[model samples]
Target: MIKLPKILKYPNFSRLYYAGLTSELGSFVTETALMLLVFKLSEGDKSKLGIIRASFLFFLTMGSLLGGPIGEKFNRRNVLIFANIIRIPIITVLFFSKDFYSILLVNAMVAFFTGIYNPSRQAMINDIVPQKEISIANSLFGSTMAILHMVGPFIGALVFSKMQGIDEILTFDLITYFLGIALISTINYRPPKKESVDNVQTSLFYDLKEGLRYAQKREDLRALLFNCSIAGFCIGVLIPLLLPFVTEVLHLSDREYGLMLSVFGLGGFFGGIISHRLTSKHRPGKLIVSSIAFEPLLMLLWLLIPVFIPNLIIFFFWGVIVFIRIPSQLNYVSETVETEYLSRIHSILDLSFVVPNISGGIIIAFIGNSFTTMEMLFCTAILFVILIFFKMFTSSSKALFKSEAKRVTRDQSIQDGIA
Candidate 1:
């Protein structure tokens, strides 16, 4: 078991975590308020709101697709700082936009920059953190994000309800973004040395092909990515339907819906804490499978609870299980990949979700949300079950566990060589 070190003891990591928390909280506040503002402007029309939300996802996907090559080409920390600086004006524009199209444009821009920001930030962590502690670090990161989700929306709701308009929320978000920029700028870490100039001079197609080839050649990583893409697709189905289910089927109000999201965040927060502690004690594959198995059961239970209970007790439990899956999965991905390619690999994995999310939205639009959710959940559950069985029969699970061991051994050998 690899005992994890406390992040508080690492000054740089502590600053990074605090900055991420503040920025994430601000983002949640801004997003929630923006959704409300769009609703108000559209006269209770949901389609426009959906379009606004979907545009952000679309641009984010574009940004991530571009982010990999840029991060590899430039200093990732500088890119991150630059991304933060660029957001201020975009967010400010959003604050005063007179029409829905203007607001959508600004939000889309913000999403694009945020997409660029994420891969760089992830790469920075890889540069700063030790290999052994990557899981714990990622867990802490996930926890902070979950905490922001838990508190940020409620704060946004309260501020929105008390204030006259969305401007205040946008202002708050802008302030946090600047604050994050300031904090990130203060960090003094150097970027990892790149491959030689000869390596750098390769055509863009070659660079991308290399990344793709690396992914295809790594057997364990290939399996992990396959499962991750499937799980992401399932999650895409679940996310859009959750609020609707709470409102339409459970007869909940907006406040109740917010509360349900908060519960989910709380669950994620605790899951992050648990994962930080448990990563050293168990195989990540085992943890991932357990988390994946729990998700469908919880979703099914969420659907069934309405039959017996008057209130949303099962919703809270479902939130816990659902949130738990995120950090565990992230840690697994981080641990599976080498540090040099971590950012690009993570971006590729993220794209798996982005494609599914966009496709899921379209499918929902065509088939209706309820049917889409049911179909996705059932299919995902059955798929994971089959994978688990195949893994057991073919000894793939043992191979995955051994892969981690080999990674650690290789790291030790490198360190010993340097010594």
Candidate 2:
């Protein structure tokens, strides 16, 4: 057996890790359950299902937008605990919801709180871990979530197979949340110093605008955000269409679909491990950009390849590439940005996906029913490929160079101060 890192030995981080693990496991279960429920409620109407999903995302985005300041200003631990606590009742309501709209409403509410939970948790992680160890921390954190994502679906499948209803799964989800609350309560954390009462308070709008101004001033931050935004848009387009592609285009069974998903998650787990081990030696930004750039080409390949086995193989690798960049990507942000502004920055980045998620279906719909699925996919792939290269080479090249120089200078200053 491999020896555990010394960081894992820290009781507080360990507790926090377990809390996240349980919460993620539960979320995945709920995710699977929600998907199934939506399918049932919509009677497998793809359009309606999309609407439900979009609804949840809309509220989530709004929550994230508003939650950023709260995370930055408040006690993150309390915020996290409250977020989890509030979710219980919301999920409980979801359990008993018989109507589709009720389910949608409850889900939206839950997602709203989730938006709060996520940034608070992320900010808290930065507080708990030292700057030097962030990469390892993220890798371990990413790996745990990936593994849970891989297994949770199976657990959901098993439970669904046994119970054949959403109720039992919801109950399990509630229990997991409770456990998460219990686990996280034990963690010791310190919030930043409060602003002096004598100082004039900035309005929320002012604070938000300030964050935007800060981001705008940094060419690298802007470039990175642009890259992330594009990536999120492309990903959003792919997510809603994956099930249909697997079932209709690939002609795969539900079992095969589940297997494909599991394999994909497994790939993510390995990718996280590799990222952790290689962080010191590798150019993470390059690796991340390269992986995302390759995604379109990979999708195109998956679409063109007629063989199911080959497609699964391609998809597994796709998963690896998808998750492999997360730790690096996040580490880059944490390393580049000031701690005081990190949560707001995360919230801003979260919008990249949120906007795309809400608009993806509309984009798909406007293209006309006459186009074949393959044609649409092909066009999307080509567009993403072009856009990605253009963004990297034309738009962000100078920014990246500037950011690198700035980072070096900052590091030197810090070292000089220490010396």
Q: RMSDs, each prediction?
A: 4.8, 4.0
What are the per-residue Cα lDDT tens digits for candidate 2 across 201-275? 766566667777887887766776776776666665565556556667877644565566677788788888888
In model 1, the runs with Cα more than 4 Å from the true position are 1-5, 43-46, 197-200, 203-205, 307-315, 365-405, 408-419
Task: TM-score each candidate.
Answer: 0.84, 0.90
Quality of model 2 by C-alpha lDDT: 0.71
For each candidate in the order shown, give its overall lDDT on alpha carbons: 0.66, 0.71
Which structure among the candidates has the greatest TM-score? 2
Stretches of candidate 2 off by over 4 Å are 1-3, 194-198, 362-375, 395-398, 401-419
Please report, as a residue range, the 10-residue window in candidate 1 with the lowest summed lDDT: 410-419
Clashing pairs in 1: none
Least accurate 10 contiguous residues by lDDT in model 2? 410-419
Clashes of each: 0, 0
